[model samples]
Target: MPDPHSSDAEPRPAHSAPSSLLSRIKALLRPAPPADREGIRAVLEAAHDHSILDGESYAMISGALEVADKTVADIMVSRSRMDLLDVSLSLTEQMRTIIETGHSRFPVYEGDRDNIIGVLLAKDLLLTLSDHALDIRALIRPPVFIPESKRLNELLHQFRISRNHLAIVIDEHGGICGLVTMEDVLEQIVGDIEDEFDDEDEKTIFRTGDNSWRAMGTTEIEDFNDVFHVQLPDEDYDTLNGWLAAELGHIPRRGEHFQSQGLTFTVVGADGKRARWLHVQRVSGASSSPETHTP
Candidate 1:
């Protein structure tokens, strides 16, 4: 029989020893560097340069960092663009709106959009179709209200804990300002998350003819400038529509044309108030101006 505690016994393998204690000790001894935003950005940029992060991943990391600074108001769908359902509307009417918008959820309002009562999930309507007597109120889940000034990162954490996807943004006066969704928050990080409803081939801005182009209202001003090879001041507003509206001092109606900065902007398609599609034609040999105009 082998003698117990014998020195002659086969030595334990060098690699078999637990290294967690040493690792912990080493970690404790190493000085931790301060992690400021700039430091974090430098690290991320370095990682991107080393091919450890792809372009998309790098952008997302930057966006995540940005989320800490941005408030819900920065990314929320403005009240004007919100597709709200009136609880008083017929079920069929509500269903029609749901189909037209291609949105999965809608804020259910009472008399006005500001007086939001609850949220309506499109899937919840399926059960009510069989029984007309079924209470639509029962289908509405409790709505989540958030302040416009709420930091997006904090909101994301709250969303995770509550398992709620949508939030109604309110102002200091407690009036509904707009609505925010998990998708909206995520888009800030992942760029646009196009779904089946989105047209993959759709162009936000397209050249129509020589020195002429067509742009969607929602097109980003930066993208427009890049495409047109012209500098359009993007300080006050982000979207072409918003810039046009600001210049006009109100939303322009269809057929309204305005010229400024050596370009003619015509509202080719509009929805009574807001310009939906704009036709832009650059004036031949026209000198550009530093100002935006509504004339």
Candidate 2:
């Protein structure tokens, strides 16, 4: 009989490229039995030999496996970052405001952000604008309520089937919490998303100019270190807000001024007790300054 250990034992095509991914996958599947430490090593080695999988495919499989474990809280835009329509206004006012904000989809609320009634499409507003006062009640679409722990992939499918872009994410107590958009869901599949509504100029944290810097309050203390290249060591804070709070020892009111590490923080606009907005600038070299006053 012909030698069984000869070339006949290798049944694979001789012309196959050494880098052929299918050939490597076949190699990976060829292992037998207990698959102990050594066998596991072979699986990894075989995987390395093949380009059978790509980054996108790996992300998809990983996402599917971990999706249920992922929460809407993980993917939902924070309330501070949300662009929602305060539906307490008249329809005309709402439409005008939405136009100014440049957001096509908006969450509509009756009295407060916590009482979201439904979502309104910009197209619907245009249709109703012919009348003096567009009827917001009539233009409202049914709100899709999602828990903060809902899986993103499931929500994406829901968005497709229902043709809804905005979903109101609710907390366990049924309070209106955050908002998630179809774009937010898509960003999960891809990476960070840049859309028309997002201002390119506002993308960076601290933007410097002639004697002014517009910074997002959420910019990290470490980033503050990097941008100004300074070491302001306040042990208790990681955000400008935290720094301001620590300096003030209380929630700062509008027009309050505090100084630390050669920088001055002025509370520009505040909602009640919390500092909703701030103006930050390097303290000009001068004599001692008076307490800040608001206009």
Candidate 3:
């Protein structure tokens, strides 16, 4: 009873067939409902077995681990950079420097600046008369010294075990070269550890060399320029090192030196792609050179 010549009686169109095929393909591609834990584990193992931390995070952890292997020379503020009090000073003079520097502790040195007596607490001084005759031998706490090559983690453990916050880092000859505090170690773990004494406007900076400093990677280009007195012409890069590299057209190396404006930039450390630490000094004047040692 059907009309065979009519289109309605003919086969379906190619376009219509393709639509049906597409729906079937989509259904096949759809994800399977999540299975039981064991089944999921099997699927995960089958898919891939190795995926851990990615690029940036891995670098951060590696850098921190490197801290453990580094000697105190890698991080310690050298004696030249230290703000210390001479024990021979009239008690009034010692108190004055303390108030100016806002330092709670000072390394007491004798006749030769190299000879360290002991660590003195400012609060102890505050309790006594500044004009009173002082005997550093009586008030002194025992000096804590560690080899420059000790691992930071080991040093930290020593700090905890000994209940000591201050330590003098010594060279092979037993000469005092630098000092480290509990706060310095804590900063590595927690990042930019600040105290009530730290200035709000000041950023945490590491002196990378005699003439340069390494700043936090996140620092702004403007802030970097202001801090270092560099006149980097390009507005493109955010860090001083980034600007330097862009200007030089290559990554800088250790002992490689450059200058701009009134500042001298010397590479002290690096991690291939970027400058890790830079030693900066003002060209207008020279400060007394501090003795450096390889631990």
Cα deviation of 289 in candidate 1 (Å)?
30
Give the per-residue lDDT digits (tens) of candidate 2, residues 1-295: 8787798775767867866978888988985653564554455445545856565665554445455456788867556555567766777666544643345677777777777787888877666667856567777788888898888778888889998888888888988777888876665556445444335354434333455454444556777778766675547787766766665777766556676556666664343335544556676773243434332
Residue runs of model 2 more than 4 Å from their true location after superposition: 1-50, 54-68, 128-132, 197-295
What are the TM-scores, per candidate, against the unseen true structure? Answer: 0.58, 0.50, 0.49
Q: Which stretches of candidate 3 lie over 4 Å from their true place?
A: 1-64, 129-131, 199-295
How many clashes does each candidate structure show, in the order listed? 0, 0, 7
lDDT of 1: 0.79
Better of 1 and 3 by TM-score: 1
lDDT of 3 by residue, 1-295 (tens): 8887887897757799789999999999998864764554454444443445554444455445656766666666576656677877777666555643444677888888788888887767655774477765566687788888888888888899998888888988999888888767765655555444434367645553455454543345687666665555546887767876765667755455666666656554443466555555666653333222121
lDDT of each: 0.79, 0.64, 0.64
Model 1 poorest 10 in a row by lDDT: 193-202
Each prediction's Cα RMSD?
A: 11.0, 11.2, 15.0
Q: Better model by TM-score, 2 or 3?
A: 2
1 or 3, greater by lDDT? 1
lDDT of the structure predicted as candidate 3: 0.64
